[model samples]
Structures are given as structure tokens and as C-alpha cells.
Target: MAQWIRGWGQRGWAAPAGVCLCLFLLLTACGQSAPTGEKCLNCHEGIEEISAAHPMESFACVTCHGGNPQATEAEAAHAGMRGGRNPSDLAVLDAACNCHNGLAETGQDHIHRVRTSLQTTYAGAIAQVAFAFGAQPDPTARYGMLAVTDDNITTATGQPALELFRPGPDDSPMLHRFADNCLFCHVGGEPLAQPYFYRSTGCAACHMVYDNDGLYKGGDPTIDPAEPGHAREHRFTTAIPFTQCNHCHNRGNYSLAQMEFLPRPDLPDDRPLTDLERRELEYYQPIAQFTLCEWKLDCIDCHTNGEVMGDGDIHSSKLEVQYNQCQTCHGTPDALPLLTTIDSVDHPAIRSANLNPNYEVRVGDTVIATTRGETFGWVLWDGQRLWLTKKVDGMVYEVPLALGTACQQKPDEQASQYCHECHAYQRTVAPLP
Candidate 1:
């Protein structure tokens, strides 16, 4: 018997290198008079292109390439004009990784953390929450607040008002959808904008736990959060699928970028809004359930510093929470100068000053001036953080404390934040030094 062999590099046969063995077996098992489909050796010979293209998948001939197996003529059976089992939707041309056995995996540059777990029994829970509050407004009050624009319907009489609003906590279908979970955040709020499609309203806006400092810190070569040993896996509130920001942002007619939300602590604009507008606004609120739509700044823009508090400096907290944005109009602590440039300024460096030797400077009924011509006052102690006083020259001054001279104390509720503790101006200095 003459031997037949083909090299691996041959183009058109999407099959394994052992194709010849399959052909030999086919020829031996089916005699020369066997049907073309049955004699896979005869009909599958030249169709090497299919096999070559899908070397792995092309090997299973009967699965797709076989029909009317006993028919001898290629035209009679193998002509694919006759039907065969077509590819299933599950097996059809989807990206390999997308169909990876039902596992929900996200690619780099995408947020995939699950943020909330809503109960399947949503309707009942929502009704209960609304009824418990018993703070529902009257239906007339709600409709009275509606503007022609709210309904998107134009009236013959210059935007006729509609009777839409009703009393009851989150009784509307819209509010119910919102309370069930936070779907509105990514859908609108800070949707991906031009150039970069990263949503300004999505989890990426605030809880972006994928960055260097976010999930990793300082250069430590052995670090690899993706792997098991590197660090704790970063958990987030929610994750977006498809990993493409452009899909939502760049699409034309994508005006429904995010829901405009009601005002909250950080954002104080939503108040004074009519009850009707407040309901519509919740869908567009920022991550903190606040509004930052036109402002163009996210949570990270202001909260760039991190603090270590809670026994051993291990727990994470904001190092500073100054709303310096307000200080442009208000005043900052005299010790801390205002950052003139909002964008390019480097954050001021702060070090824990040692407060030892427990010293005190007193100002009696009448203030006194020091030999250096510095004026003295109540000798404000910043709770072991710093010693502050006003100089006669009319300038506020800060003095470093001696080591072990002071102890750290928890800031009061109102002064818990570095910015709050320092910026609320109570006194004006006489003159600058």
C-alpha cells in the first residue's frame, strides 16, 4: 500500500495533524462503493480550507458538514443545499471570552463590582417603607408644582398644568424603581462624556477601586491584587458590563445620560425645589445621592487625601474634608493659606506635630504683646494637633507642639473634618506681621 502524508503548514485543512490517519480509517472502514458522506476520505479531501481555518473545530465533519450520509454523489447529499444541523445560538460566533461557561467576568477599564442586593419581593417592601414614613404630600400639592415642561407635553394654553402629583412616600412607580436599587446612577448622572466615555455618574466616579493608590500603593514589586497573595481583593458597590464606556456616551441621541438627582449635604441645590421636581431629580443624583451635573467635579476631585485613624492608624478615612470650594467666598483658617489655583495646585503637606512640654500662653482681661512684638490671645489648643494664637501684628500663627506634650482627641461632630475644624472663621486679626 502506498503511503500518503501532508505537512502541518498546508492551508485549507482546519484539522489536526492526524488528518491522514482519519482518512485511512475512513477508506478502510467504507469500501470504494461507500456513499460520499460515509466515505469521509473521498468528499472531505479538498475541503481542506475549512479545516485549515478552524483546525480545532473543523475536525468534527459530521457535526456540520455531513447530511444524507448514505448518498454517494456530492451533489445529492454533501451539497450543503440540503439542510444539516446549524450552529446553536450558544455556539454561534460570539467572542470566546464572552461565552466562557456562564462566568461573569469583567475586563480591565470596566467596573464590575456588585453594589446593592435588592429583595426579589420589591413591591411589598417599597409600599411598606412609604406607608411607614406617613410623610406623603397631597396629590393636589404635587400636581400644583408640576410645570408644562415636566410632562414633556405642550398645552394649547401655554403649558397647561397637569394633575399628576399625589401624597404618599415614594408611592410613584418611578420612586419605587429607584428605592429598589441604584440603577439610575450609571444610566444617567455622570454618563460617559466626549473624548473619554467613562461615566461621571457611575461607580467609577467615586468608588474606583482599580487604580494604583485605590487598590495598590507605593512601589512594592511583589504586589499583584489580581492574584491571590498580593492584597485584599477590592470590593465595590457595582460594576458595569461590556467594559466599553463609548457604547453609551458616544451613541448619538443618547441624551438620557443620567438622572438629575435631588440635593444632599455636599450638594445643597436640590432644596427649595418643588416636591414634583425632587422626585424627578433623584434619578439624576450623583454618587453620594447628591447633584454635581453642571459642576464637572467628582468625589475624588475634592477627597484626594486619605487618613489612617481608629487604633494603629489602620482604618481608612478622609485625611481632609475641606470644602475649599466654598472658601473662595468664605475664609480658610489663617494658618492655612487658600489654594489660588484650583486645578494645578499640589495638596498641602501636613505632618503630625509633637506637642510636648505642655506649654501655655495666656491673655488676661487685657491682651499683652511679646518681646518680639507678637500679640497674644486665648492660647487656642487644637487638641494636641497644633497651638494657635493671634499675633499683635494681627496675623494668626501656628506653633509646633513638643513631643508627648499633647494627646489626640476625637474631633467634635461639627469639627470632625480637617476643613471644618479650621475654616469656620470666628475672629479677625488686628493686622498682619
Candidate 2:
């Protein structure tokens, strides 16, 4: 703490000594740690809470991201930091394990789950590409970008382990092409440093949002606004907008033969784009049959924590873990949706509500849960109808349950592809006016 006070000016803390002394006394009286209250704040004075749950006043920068907060210079201060700057990077995620890393059914296992999820490993993509090129015997995953092991294999599809995918001299050229081109799409690596492709590594890639241009738009005077490839702010959120997901998922296509990523043509920056036009490009391919709910709600609304993050298991394909079906929330003609009340404070669903401020998750409130027992905030029942509270904006929509509606949805065929038979959206783009 003493060394931090001495080194404050090195990071551009050019305030008067009297003001600094007064600030120190105020922080001490208010019961904040001297180092967190003054040192990093000296340069990042106007920075707001990373999130309401993780107030900047409570957490020191070094708590999640290991660094010498007491050091007198940038090089020395950042000497032992995790993942360079982004602690969420899977390569060095253990640094922030105190809060997020776990192997149990506990909500804290997010980091652990994501580390093994198909998103990080790109297991399905790799396995398919290898199989297509005759590099692998079958489409079932034998390798992934990162070598992962699940000691507790609870599911039938779960693999005991996966080796780091390394193609040999005898391997197909397509395998080498996959290794070169498609690997960057996974969360294990930072994304492209271009517009519409800006994001961080690992968990931060989703939780922390980056603008299409990837500039820091927050009030931190120390950060550079002109800098691209940075999250818009130092905030983490569960209420991730669709745009954040679009950074990776909806951006473009890949050519297996050429082993290359073919970015979709950029919307002309020459003119101000329309919302309809932007939504068309941002969410859908040229002719997608998405439902109204799919367009309205943020990606996180339908895709719960369990569906997005793995269940501490390694799997060959996302289809094994991606169990968020259209009928999961909306029940079939045979019955209403299966509902569970928040029975325990320690229930993982509570954390879902706490992280997102869209709705209150309380005991005795009838809410929907996935077939795998994972629940999210909002989308609750009021006897008359089920309500879906949008995550990005607090827009409430009447969840159309198929209990009495004219629907012939079979129990076995509830995947999204089945829903599009009747509920598909066809968006017509009015030529940019």
C-alpha cells in the first residue's frame, strides 16, 4: 500500500497532494481498503462499478486478476497478471477460481463448464471437419482445440477425455486447414481486431460487451477511446444483448475446401443503416426462419447457463448438451410446461436472477426449468399465462404455451427446426432508404 502511494504519479495521477490526502482519509473513514481505494483509482478515477454485484469499491483489481498492486511501475505491476490483461482466458482462468471455478452442481462452476463447453473446445466443428476429410474415423469428437478431461462423466454422450487436436504429416490438408482457419472462432483465443468481430477471450468474450468498432466508450480516463479490440466498458453482465453474441456466431461463413473464414460483406458505412436492415444482417443469414421470440429476446433468454456452459462434462457435439428446446419453455398439447418454484436460496437459479436484474426470482414463484433442471430469471407463470421478461430490455411478452392452442407438436420433435414449420419469421429488407 505504501509503495502504491509512492508510485501513484508513475501511472499519471497528477492531482495535488492535499486532495490525495483528503481522498485517502475519506476512504479510510468509509471502510475501504487503502490500496483499492486510492492506487488504481488514481488513474481510473471515473470508472464505475464493474457490476452492481461486484462493486468497484469492494474488489481490488488484483483480487480476480493477479498483479502486484503495490508495485511502482507498469511493468512491475503487471509482471504476474493472469492471461496478460483478460483473466477469463482459459489458459490462465485458474487465477480467478476463487469465485467461479468448481466441479459440483454449484452455480460457481461456470468457468469450469465453459472451459469444457463446445464453444471453447469447438469439438463438434473439429470432429466434423476431420471426418469429412477422412482424417477421423467418425464424426464423434476425438479431439478439440484444447485438451480437456472430465473425471466425472455423468452423461452417456460425455467423453472421458479429449486430446489437443494435432494433425500429423499424413493427415488430410482439410484437417490442417481447419487447424489454421477455424480455431480462432473458439473462446480460447482472442477474436479478430476488426469491426463486427471485436471481443475478449474466454468468459469475458460474452460477459463483457464490445461495440461493433471495439472502442472503450466508458469514462475511464486511462483507457484509450481510439483503441479497437477492447470491451466498451470494464463491466461484466449476464444480461448479454444479441449484439454481443453476434460478434462470433452470426458474423460469417466458412469454406471447408479452401479452409478459410469468409466474412459476410459489411453493411455500407457510407449511409446510416436502418434497424430492420441491421437486424437482418446481425441476427440471421439471408433466409432464416426465426420466430418472433427469437428476434425479440436476447440470446441469454432462451439459452440458459446450463445450455450455454457445459455440465462439467466433455461431449462430442453441442447437440448432446444443447437441450434448450422450443417445448422446454412452452409445453405441448398433452400438458402445461413443467414448473418448479425456487425452493432454496442456494438453488443455482437464484444466481441467475441475481446476475440479471430483469426480474425477481423468489420462493413459491412458478417458473420453467430445463429438462436438465437449470432455470433462468423471468419467464414465470401467473396462472393465466406464462410471461417472458426480455433480458436486454425489460419488455414482457406473453409466453404462448401450446396447452390449448392448435398445435400438433410431438414430444419427440420439439427442437427449433420443428417449430419453424409454422412459426418461422421471414423478414423483408426495405432497400436502405
Candidate 3:
């Protein structure tokens, strides 16, 4: 009988619980027996059963959620399945929300204080100091800037020639041309060089924002609180704050020196400031000579005059209001105008004057000229005088009528002597023949 049972176990037949052969024999006789791993799954489909249960859906019974379908002894089966624990015991699991969600309620204070740190996962790439061109080091703040051209008329003569944008279509009430904002100086085409030391022209790309609350009236600002991460306040100051400005301005990721590693014509000739130097520095430090040394005020302080100044106590027009700000100290003690001009004088025998040949000329106007680097057109000769004025668009004009004769002819010193002999005439007859 034992040999027959061994043959049965060796074949595909199910194995009885071998601990007590007598009990197995009696159970088999009573038509009750145990099934092995393969025999039970043949009818039950254990894989499908295990998958239907959500708690154990992630693993098979043998993987972790342990059980012994093949065993008959209760104690041995429980020990094998649960490492000596009862097989029917329920396991405690960790909370899903705790591991994968937003910050906890207790951590809210720390999160809100650092607005930059509170940036959501989707706030675009992290911003570096150099990355944000024209971005202020302080928390979101701003100022406006302007450039204007006006028709500076002479009250003495009602001359209509005082036009800012002349030789063009006259469209507006005033004769003037103007542009404002950082682009005026930062952009190309103007004679002024672009500032590499300062912010780039692409400031609007990242900084552009809109306020959904269109003009809030009588609302408590503290209760509404500028709608987190938005710029609602209109006023800003150049006065640097202690930790406020240093958060983004001092050494580290947002250091000014790091942003200005490249060659910049606008930067001062000094390297990184020492601790002593930084301590000595003023809050709204004045720029040096090439960068307007005396002007402690910034661009917006002078430009945003009527809108923000005196209206809401906004200090926008501090510079414009005090036009005497600069002149008050620099001008004459008697309050005379800071600037003075010299009027035109008349001199007839002036030789080297009226050199453009426009004022004084003769019938046979043969003028000998020497070649300079890129010299062009005829030099003005009054027959008796050799005239000189800066050339613009291939034409040169004498700035003052009398003193055109004395300007030094650099490359040609002999130009003065040569004109005295060959070309000489009276101022009354110069004309285009």
C-alpha cells in the first residue's frame, strides 16, 4: 500500500497530508482527502480569484499575502503561510494621501512665506538671476521710463522751423516724437550702445501679467492681499531694504556679479565688492559719470509725473517735481538759469569763415581739396575765408555765421593757407550758378 501511495505521489495524482498516514487512510476511505498546488487550481482558477480582491490585487498568494491551499494540518499551514502568525489576521497599511499629496496643514506657514519656494510643480523652469532679464532683485516691483522729443520754439522769433519730427507727415496736436520703457535705451538703431550690464529687451516675455480684479474699490487690501504672486501695488522705491533686496541681489544664485560675468560697457571698472565696500555703499547708489553719476533717482521717478504722484501719495514724480533738484545746488546763487548761450556776432573780413561756399562765392569757383579718411563734397570757401562745419548726409553748414573761419583743418594745416590765396570773395554774391 505504501509503494502504491509513493507511485501516486510521483505521478500527477494529488498528495494526501503525510503527517499521519493512519488519518490519511481513514479520510481517504471516507472519501475525504487533500489536494496539491496543481490539483486545486485545476478547478478553482486561483490567479483570477486573487486578482478580484483589491487589497491583494497587486500580488500572488505566494508572493506576500501568504496562504497554503496544499496543506492539511492547520498549525503547519498557518506557520508556512504567515511566518508563524495566524493566516486569518488582517494587515495594517499606510495612508496613500500622506505619501503622495500637497504639503501638510502644519507646514503651510513655512510654505507661504517663501513665495518663490511655494511655486507649483508646473510654474515653468526654475528662474535664475541672469535668466530673468530686467527682473528686479527685490520682490515683484516696478517703475516706468520715458524718452521725449519736443518742438523747442524760440519765443523771440515765431519761426515755424522748430519741429521735432520734421520733414514727415504731421499727424498729432504737437510736433514731437517719443518712446518709453527699457526698450528705448536697450534696443538697437540709436547711437547709444546697448547695455549688457543691465536687463535684456525680453523682460515682457516672462514678466507679462494681468489682474483679473479690474480696479478694486473700497475693498480691504489686507483681506484680499494682492491675490498671491500678482503685482497689484503701483508704487516702488529705489531705496534698498536689508534682507529684502539681498534675497535676490546678494552673492549666491542671484548675485549681480554672476549675472554680469561677460563684458559690459555699462558696468563700473571695479570687481566684486568687498565686505567693507558693500557696507559703505548707499541704498539707491548713484551711477558714475558715464552712467549719470549725480542722478540718484531712477527712470520711473522722473517719468510717471501726473498719474501716480500726489494722487495716492505714490512717489512717482519725485524727480520731475523738483526740476531744481540738480540746478538748485549747481546753479548761480542769484537763481539765474543754469545754462547760458552766446548770440551770433557779425564780422565781414573774416577769412576761413563761410567755408561751405554757400555764403560767399565767385563765377569761376575752382576749389582744391585734400583727401581725408572718408572726405566727400566741396569744402566751403568764402574766397577770402575757409569755412568749416560738421558734415551730415554729405552736406556741411556753418553753425555760427561769423566763426566758421577759425576751425582747425586737422589733416590739412595748409588748407587754411591755400584757401587764403586761391579763393577770396565778398559774402554778398555767393550763389549756385
Candidate 3 yields a Cα-based lDDT of 0.23
As for lDDT, the candidate ahead, 1 or 3, is: 1
Question: What TM-score would candidate 1 get against the native?
Answer: 0.19
Across residues 103-221, which tens digit of lDDT does each residue of candidate 1 receive? 12211111111111011111122233344444343211112111112222221212223232234454554444444332223221333222223322222233222221123332333
**Residue 121 of model 1, lDDT score:** 13
Query: In candidate 3, what are the lDDT values of residues 265-349, reduced to their tens digit?
Result: 2222244665333333322222212112112222221221221111111121223122322211111223221221111212111
Top-down lDDT ranking: 2, 1, 3
User: Who is ahead in TM-score, 1 or 3?
Assistant: 1
TM-score of model number 3: 0.16
**Residue ranges of candidate 3 with Cα displaced over 4 Å:** 1-263, 266-270, 274-325, 328-331, 336-433
Q: After superposition, how far is residue 262 of candidate 3 from its true place, in Å?
A: 12
TM-score of each: 0.19, 0.87, 0.16
Ranked by TM-score, the better of candidates 1 and 2 is 2
Extract clashing residue pairs from model 2.
none
User: After superposition, which runs of candidate 2 have C-alpha atoms over 4 Å from their true positions?
Assistant: 1-38, 266-270, 273-277, 408-412, 430-433
Q: Which model is ahead, 1 or 2, in terms of lDDT?
A: 2
- Candidate 2 Cα deviation (angstroms), residue 383: 1.1
